[model samples]
Target: MPDESKLPISELQPDQIVQAAITSHQPWGITANLIAYESVGASLDVIRRGSEPGVKALAMNLPPVGTTIDLAIGALRSWHYEPWVWVDLTCP
Candidate 1:
């Protein structure tokens, strides 16, 4: 594993899998804390494609705060100048 603490957000590449701890519940998804990059925030869209409706429903139920999950880096997005990590649900 790379030195997570020293890894800059800009250095994060797509398709890299990482563990993140869910921090809060969102109506549309969940907000997570990227375990490797403290400065970056992660989000997962529970209703995304590739999963069945039932599976999506289960995911939509939401995990308790602090639940850790494995996710792949889909893309980096900016919101008001802040960087956000969008997890990929398409990859296994």
Candidate 2:
């Protein structure tokens, strides 16, 4: 399991942006939150804890934030919150 204490707080850069998703166990059951990453080394804080499942844990690499390169719930199940559908973040 990746340590949440080491999560990074640096702002994301243009090249870092990636199609990402955050999943957690909530009262309704396992849920996923889709998000966009702006950098390779960025941190996504857990704002609120779910009601039922109570968010027992979270897993993601996110550069300096964690050690593991990929987030996984167990031995097999893993989620890649990076390298999703690439898009232009420079245009207004």
Candidate 3:
């Protein structure tokens, strides 16, 4: 497997998905850790214990248009929150 952090857009192949993570975050006022599938799914690991992991997922429905994050990372692909390279790659 390729090192996700070091992987660049130029090295990405067609139809590939990458996994990215943030240790702690409060997206939309909810404190949690984020695991974006980058336009495929958005997995939110709740900060507090006892809460179901990924309580809210983008796979079910997409956020409204023009939302920078939404536009940057599509619904579900955000699994659904990693920074997918091919989705934004500028080929030479």
Could you say which candidate leads in TM-score? 1
- Predicted model with the maximum lDDT: 1
lDDT of 3 by residue, 18-77 (tens): 333322234432211123332222333323221332233442343333232312221222
Q: What is the lDDT of every predicted structure here?
A: 0.64, 0.29, 0.29
Residue 14 C-alpha lDDT in model 3: 42
TM-scores for candidates 1 onward, in order: 0.66, 0.18, 0.22
- The alpha-carbon lDDT assigned to residue 65 of candidate 1 equals 92
Consecutive 10-residue window with the lowest summed lDDT within model 2: 69-78
Best-to-worst TM-score order: 1, 3, 2
Clashing pairs in 1: none
Candidate 2 on 36-75: residue-level lDDT in tens?
Answer: 3322322233333222132323312122321223222211
User: What is residue 54's positional error in candidate 3, in angstroms?
Assistant: 7.9
Q: Candidate 2 regions off by >4 Å?
A: 1-41, 49-54, 59-66, 72-92
lDDT of 1: 0.64
Off by over 4 Å in 3: 1-5, 11-16, 29-55, 58-92
TM-score of 2: 0.18
Question: Could you tell me which 10 consecutive residues in candidate 3 have the lowest summed lDDT?
Answer: 70-79
User: lDDT score, residue 54, model 1?
Assistant: 36
